[model samples]
Target: MAGPWITEHEVSVVEDAMRNGWYEHAYDYCEKFQAEFAVYHDRQYGLMTPNCTTAIHLLLAGLGVGPGDEVILPECTWIASGAGVTYQGATPVFADIDPNHWCIDPESVEKLISPKTKAMIVVDLFGNMPDMDALQAVADKHGIFLIEDSAEALGSVYKGTRAGKFGIGSVFSFHRTKTLTCGEGGMLLLDDKELYERCSMLRDHGRRPGGPAYFNEEVTFKYMPFNVQAALAYAQFQRIDELVGKKQEQLNQYREKLSDIDDLQLNPEPEGGINGAWISAVVFGKSHNMSKHKAIEELEKLDIPARPFFYPLSSLPAYGEMIDEYKTRNSIAYDISERGINLPGAANLTGEQIDKVCDGIHRILT
Candidate 1:
């Protein structure tokens, strides 16, 4: 699907970047994407990174979130969200999620905050934005940093505000599977100039911000986004409305076809803002007596590429030692992970393809 969207403009942009030579200067091309992306999200600045993981890592480091600090995270998210906190030598506290939207519950977040808590990484998973307005108020009252991991949600909005605009720093991913693709890339959106400057330095081997190049100030990885990818990303960004619309259409097809099946929970569009995402997901009810694994296996046999939702943080072996501290008893996240499956909602997936996918699900469930 990503392949179909590649226009000649992206190729020409890459070629132009190549002719100019990235070594001598990359800021010209990269900065254009960053600036344009910031404007799109209504953020003050945007810093491009190698990926969202690195974006969150740099965000944590820039904000001085480190050893002995604690960052509360939604229990069900890509491991990167928790790893970002781990990289800073901080504890990753886990909390339950709201069953309806599968986003971190604000009340759960408030309960987890303590003197050691410095921030909360709210994941807008599968294009669903949580109650950021409620969560932001909690953060403001407690003075904890609110970080939005909108890596899976690019154009998703809640209460008329863009996903990444609610926090001190928010991340967006442009991985091949993401709504926008640059093969692999990320963007950090924020309002603070000082924080932005720190992120810039951390992204480029700790150079003293600005640049004549080759002035290393401290130890940092090469997290900078390449101009070539940036060019490709900007090209994809140009067609965002078309891409989002196509996904929403595909989602509609899934719901219209599958919604009649009793005991099958399809993705819900809780109206507050434009929840026009097309993330085709289904959670099997207790009566179905089928595990998500079995559904995925059956889908694969039919060549229907389905993905499982993330295992709750406590459910995974990686977070074994901290289970007692972070685990919430009878977590809804764990229940959702056990039952949910994500079908292919590729930006370029054809109506025929979506139909086949839905037909396969209907056959399996019945």
Candidate 2:
């Protein structure tokens, strides 16, 4: 796997956290990072978590989603999105994705809404935003909550608004593979003070802030994020623009290198929308003789790492009961997964390395 672009600043901040970040200073980095991240996204509050999955689960709990409820989500996403719903004893209803955008189709979402539907989680798949206006309209019409799973879209913008600024709340990932990461961490961003406060207390064993010491209001999950991790994340967060720019640069290089290939489609940059370009991905056209499986095999022989796009969640054994209809239910997602693959776009990768990858792909396709 390609590693994140780490610098001396991360090392220094972590060292400081290890030495001086204790007791009263334990959450210094976390507070600073959370506040800045929230401000950047125009959110009123932010809560740090061990990882994105936990953040999604906590967010769902905060929204009061539970047994017998159904949450709508796109079929093409990491299981983390669906698993969180199950944690709340809610059924995750999979929806199809837009052919070009690869995000949950608003129409598909509307079709699946039922009396059991409590909320919809829209994933900013591969750092690309779906039609938020339409999705929000659907949710508003149905009186169900809308949540944004922006794990891969930290820097993405839709209509001048950042990825995390939409819906009732949004969750982000700072995994090793993410654009801005501190090994493993996540953040919940939202504008609702009531929801934020509730999740905050619930995140720490249900101990209400400023309450009696060692007292608990209710039983809940603990998804605490430590100071050292926060320090590392804060350091990276300081260079957010630089990191996002480098990711975009990598994607730009790939786009230029593959400009002559009309049968390939890279991540989209719709008018007024800025793609985060977190993972440089491409989907081979149906007319292309190449398939993702073939591409991966050829790239492997050439020593290039090619990551496959996510399979429809319904096709996984864990959701086997829904697998039979997945192909017809989410045709665009199934088709895209078959042809799509993530390219090597590490921020620290050299131009020579990118050229090699492009050349290998060219030769394989030809």
TM-score of each predicted structure versus truth? 0.94, 0.98
Summarize candidate 1's per-residue lDDT along 237-311 as a digit string, tens digits: 888887777777777888898877788776667577765463667788878877889998998898888888778
Q: List the residue pairs that clash in candidate 1.
A: none
Candidate 2 on 1-366: residue-level lDDT in tens?
356989999999999999999999989999999999999999999999999999999999999999999999999999998788999999999999998989999999999999999999999988989999999999999999999999999789999999999899999999998999998999999898899989999899999877899999899998989999999999999999999998899889999999998889999986898999898899999888677889999999999989888888988888975767778878888899889999986668999999999999888888
lDDT, model 1, position 28: 74
CA RMSD of all predictions: 2.1, 1.0
lDDT of residue 364 for candidate 1: 87
Quality of model 1 by C-alpha lDDT: 0.83
Best by TM-score: 2
- lDDT of the candidates, in the order given: 0.83, 0.92
Worst 10 residues of 1 by lDDT: 321-330
